[model samples]
Target: MGIRPLAKARTSFAATFGGLPSGFWWLWTAQLINRACGFVMPLLAFYITEELDRSAAFAGTVVAGIGVGSLVAGPFGGALGDRFGHKPTLVAALGATAASMIALAYARSPWALIVGAFVVGVTNNATRPAHNALIADVIPGKDQVRAYSLNFWAINVGYSIAMLSVGLVSFTGYTALFWLNGATTLIGAVMIATRVPGRARPAEPTEAEEAAGGFGAVLRDRSFVAFVGAQFLVLTILLQSESGLPIAMSLDGFSPSTFGQVAALNGIVIVAVQLPLTRLYKRFPESWVLAGSSATVGIGYSVLLLGDSAWIYGVSIVVWTLGEIGNTPTSFALVARISPDHLRGRYQGLYQVAWTGSAVVAPLVGGWVIHTWGAGPLWIGCLVVALAAAVAQLGIGTRLTRRVATKDPEEQPEPAKSAPASDAG
Candidate 1:
């Protein structure tokens, strides 16, 4: 609360940035630009209802299209990165995303918009697996945790700026929003294409290697599967911010601008505290931090039941934002740790499936529930989901790191290893 914790955080912050590669900053820059310009998803529900005069159920379906895109793209993207390398995969995905956003922006009909949404999801969402593989390739083992944290920090900083801007732009019209989104995505693509050099893809696995580990390898890893599933449960509720919260706020007579203000609370909180939270979380067991995060996120939504005022919503956002701050970097670091370096892309892609599933299903389920049962029931349902996610996360902790268990950032995997570095930086 005082200068003492802030001072310590500043010290830890310096340590987090020390010794990272130059390429990482470029990656971070692209992330900042892409997210900074990200405008569509946050206000998508409003665009559909207020701008397009669509039903909430139909809006949910459109949002679900994004999830479908991520689901399809995530694994394919990871495989493409595994085979073709990271830089090219990133360039293609980002370029395709720009085109999809442009398509979505111009689509005049509901069916067209729905198809555009799905295309956006496919082209855009795969960026994660490609990105994670690149991080593993460029960064040394010791710095993976902080590297991912810094990358995530870029995402939210841009996200905070984008949300605030989108809130204001909503007053003007949505056309500009789509154009800006596509432009920024194109810019990010250009940066990576021009600046970031490519790494060679991993050699194909031998027959023995294929039998023991390959495409379906991650699927057979029980602990990793559990971790991804727990993530699915929690993301379902957290993603509700994209659609559920907006819908609820509008029903309460709030404007999209007000929704932007409330949602900005999340990005603001993360940007402010991510460094300190990183420092703080480094002190605890990763499992404990992740479990606590799941619990906190649930509690944040339950707070929604208490009131519907702007300040109330803001406080709820801050509460869950803390959970987000802790959960995200920890999960990324853990994914890097548990995943053998050779198959990190596949692992990340598989892990991403949990989030993809949530994005695909959460909005549809939440919207249907809200439509059928109203706001109160939706809040109650979030509380239930939260409990389930927390338990599942806690249970997975006992089995999380069977192959590699070093918690210190100083540790490094041996050289000339097999797929262990497949997830490499």
Candidate 2:
């Protein structure tokens, strides 16, 4: 291409992706690698029912174990990141999770599987707080939204790889899938340990922070706490797509392979459109963006109640994919708006806790509700929760802005000292 053409392209790229640190890109690369190898979760239900001869309820319980691990670990992990350093916590979480994935691959007994699941959950998701905090530490405020958007985009791209490949791998056996996931997890761990310096720990908290007391302080922030509750409800509704939707497809006589194709639609759409959508949401209030997203997600799931055809499912996927595109980056930016830099990890963890808890409860609740009551009621309940959360989000904007306005001047939102070079996809 001509030099002028190349120059134009680079300019466009920079506009879409605000300058973020090289460290953020390294973290993004690690996320891409790790999620690309994630094979077990999406097909876990099928594995349990077909290979292990277990009920959907059993599968739900196993999956719920992951949530239990994350629930316990998230905030604590965040605290560790703040106290000890983000890098070490990330390395340890990845290592432990790698071991858990291997154990899960080999386990045959229910108890073994459940224990494995719990360990995987604990180790697997514990990195979230540290990882998120590190991003905040590295990236500038002006670019935080795009930075998070790109990160979320990379994740779905990895999921697209997993979704497209895992079903094909199933014929060779799940043992291969589990081992591959472990290998990648370990690789991602090594990447961060060596490439991202985790040597710098935060200085001791100021007297105010010391008195407020970490988790106690995070809990007492009423606006943030309310936002967490809203997020928790929305997540409980949306996570059903991951846990229950595939199972319902299976029960309807769709093979795992077929279901994989249909389910991949979500990731495909995300990979295609999330960046453009991210740009669009940047123009609106985070609150309105979030509320609209929650409602759209509910509408997407409710569509599932209408029919089971490939086309119907495809339409539903598009609706919710748009919601997913908006919810995550906006939520991260919102969190940053109200959080003190020193307490960012704890705040991220509290946010992590909200959604991770949904993963724990949604599957078990969704599975049983689906098992006893049927898919229709489950969809209805999901829609109801989604709408309620949407309403709650509208209130969040008011509270979040109020808190932002009243925080200590030094604690208030400020532009990053400077931004990194912008880049497009």
TM-score of each: 0.82, 0.83
lDDT values for all models: 0.78, 0.79
Candidate 1 lDDT: 0.78
lDDT of 1 by residue, 106-171 (tens): 776878878888888889988889887788777765567678888889988887777557666747
Per-candidate RMSD, Å? 5.8, 5.4
| Candidate 2 colliding pairs, count | 5
Off by over 4 Å in 1: 1-10, 40-64, 103-113, 167-180, 203-206, 247-257, 305-310, 368-377, 406-425
Q: Residue 19 of model 2: what lDDT?
A: 65
Candidate 2 clashing pairs, residues 3+ apart or interchain: 13-423, 13-424, 14-422, 14-423, 19-420
Instruction: Show model 2 residue runs off by greater than 4 Å.
Output: 1-10, 42-62, 103-113, 167-177, 197-199, 243-258, 304-309, 364-381, 402-425
